[model samples]
Target: MARKVGIYTRISRDDEGESLGVARQREDCERLADLRNWQAVKVYEDNDVSAFKRNVRREEFELMLTDLRAGLIDGIVAYDLDRLARKPQDLERLIEIYDDRPRLEFATVTNDVNLGTADGRTMARVMVAFANKSSHDTSRRLKRKHLELAQQGKASGGPAPYGWQKGDPEKVDQEAARHIKEAQKELLAGVRIGTIRTRWQEQGLGNPREGTKRMAHHRVTHILTNPRLVGYRTYHGEILYGEDGSPVMGDWETINTVEEWEAVCAVVAERQKSQPGRSLARTYLLSGIARCGLCKSKIRGQTNHKWQPGSKGARYKYQCSKVNGGCGKVARVGEPVDELIAQLALEEQRDRAASADVSPERRWPREQELNDLNTDIAQLIEAEKNKSISVSTLLQVLPEKERQRDELKLDRARFYKEQKQAEAKDDAVDLSLEEFFDLPIERQREIVLHSLSAVFIHPSGRGKRVFDPDLIEPVWRE
Candidate 1:
């Protein structure tokens, strides 16, 4: 009886599609099996897959191991020693497998190597070590190339961030460009970072894989803080880098003007200055959502009168830090301002809901249509190969099939888009205008605080006053 032999073959991505090489390897392995008087049980081939990586996800390789462990194969044959593995870790795993199984034997054709002796084991280790070093060197070279490209303002890997598009020298994507402009506009208009996130989610923008329907506050903050938006590069946690081997201005692809960038930075700086020594013990219903319309700074709360032995039931007001040198405005007390803003916000929400349209469903092809088209494409290719149809004729027919495929894809995309739009309409919160008008002043204040991004009160010699949106209307409405 002949020994059952498992034939293994592997090729890295660098060696992919070399038909002659693959054929030679297969032939060599088959010949080795024959010389050993072993019946070839199965052939495991992983094309365009790296052996250097652990936990091989290759289907055929896994099946071969399953059969080997089941005692279905008594020996393994390969074209060359390197075909078994080029990684030291993977080679060690193979050696361990062989050591534990007494019946199993490993042999290679071109190398005339046998993994049954100490000398052979040492040789295998040396080969694996060289292969691992080669893999590491290749990885380092690729990283260097990527960094070089980044320095040249070229697309590296991942999707382009919010302000930029994916392409060479010029060719900016119109859709991405529009979103970037809108984000900048919103920022300048004194919209709170949290509000911007909510708006993005409501608009169905940002990366789909992030699993967020809206933009996050942190993401908005990151956008604001990113020097790239101001046309500079930030690398390795530092803004300044050695351009031409000397310290130079950061590599930022400026999207905003210098004045705009300075203004934004000033606003941020001012907000920080105003909030110094403020305790987190103070909780406001809409702390994160409020923004100063003038400098777009966050409005911090200050107690008008302490709840001590002298004062009880005293009020507090939310005022702009004016960090950009103070809008010279006083803050609005908790009661009146909060009520008015909440009512206005609720009204705006209601108006938005009423005006939104329920999008209609788009027609799309069924799954069977797609499957049948794919089958036809496969048949067409087979027919062309067999010379049953002329290559030119198939080429002419290919465009029609490709067009149909593209159309189907577009239709599916549009269908889902319409579905999302309709769902958004249904999800909107509806509040009556009359209810907003009739609500008690305090309740109205609460609604205002919940809804409005911020309320600005003009400065007064006296302490607190009712909130007025008029003083900062220019910034918010812009």
Candidate 2:
């Protein structure tokens, strides 16, 4: 009786409507079964699958193994041993299945094998070992090529980043590019990343990878912190440096100036270290800004969780956070002390509103100039690419243009600050003292820190839990 054989075929990458390679492999295996007078039971195929990828699921491959163990097929016929599996461990599994059935047969388009014989099993093992070695060699070569391309300042194969299109990093998307620049300025100006992220998501700003809206906060931070924005290449999270210790310039177009990128990174690192758990939570308005008048130590927010009659589950307060014995200074009620600070901030704003206009007009001309500067830089890079100008000309003129742009950015930031101050002055007059606390905690913190340089609470002797107005001194900003 003829043995039942299963024909298996696979292709690593099968482009749409282009799977002739795997089709041909299947045809060859079926023809071999016909010549040997064996019944071709079924065909199992794993399209667009790599045998070398251990984690990638090959459903048909698994099904074939299942059928083989059920005695549904006497053997598997493929174009080659490598097509069966490129990993030695995977091949060992097939060998083990064949060993369980002494009558099982295995064949390739080029060779026939008997699992019942020792020589056939030994040759099968040797073939799999060679296939595994070939897989490793191919991986090593690809990695070496990737590093070489990176050294040459080219984008190694992946989806292009925001503000850029695949294989053309020189031409940037203006709308997306503007967002990147804005994020850098915001981070440097003390706007929290979560705030920026929320605003961007609300404004319908998003990258290609994350869609047209609702991006994660870390994605926003990633764009701001990327070394690639400054025209440098990074390998495994470390910037690739030249022998002189300067960053190696990449072939891709630059976004922020190198100085601006470094400054953003420094600010982010500093904030991360200073703010402990729940850094971005913004639960306390004055946690990092207030100080203990007695010990001159930072007053941090504390929560007491003891449940008493008519008491809330968690009671919040501001206490002296001295490591070596606190001066026993604490604000028993957070609401009253917070209210007092809010009232003081509003009073200062009312006074400032009397003198300064604080309503600086938006510098549209400066913004236009910034847009023009980007055009000029792009033109310079294009000229260099076309061999119309030397790279020396690019390296020279680009920095000056970048410097001008950075200066204009600083001016724009100042205008924004003045604008916010003017708006706060209006809010102070319109909203009641209680309504001011109802604002987002971030906005409340911004207004308080903007108006006051320091808020110090002194101890008012023993058994005095009451917040004495005379003991609290706020140093208003000049």
**What's model 2's overall lDDT?**
0.74
Q: Which tens-of-lDDT digit does each residue in 198-265 have in candidate 2?
A: 77777766552322445776788888888888888877677785533346788877777654666677
**What TM-score does prediction 1 earn?**
0.37
Candidate 2 lands at a TM-score of 0.49
How close to the true structure is residue 323 of candidate 1, measured as C-alpha lDDT? 58
Q: 213, model 1: CA deviation in Å?
A: 12
Q: Tens digits of per-residue lDDT for model 1 on 1-478? A: 8888889887765322454565667888898788778899788887666676667576666677677777888878887767777777667777776777866878888775566666888888987788788878987897787666556654445446665554431334456556755554444333345555666677766543243454555676666555565555544444443322222333334566543454455444444577654432324533434555545566666677565655545476667765535563545565555455555676665666679775665445464676576667778877888899999989999779867866764455445444433333232255455655453333333444433545444444464643455643312221
Clashing pairs in 2: 153-251
> Once superposed on the true structure, which residue ranges of model 2 sit more than 4 Å away at CA?
1-85, 90-124, 166-169, 175-179, 189-222, 235-238, 241-246, 268-282, 288-453, 456-473
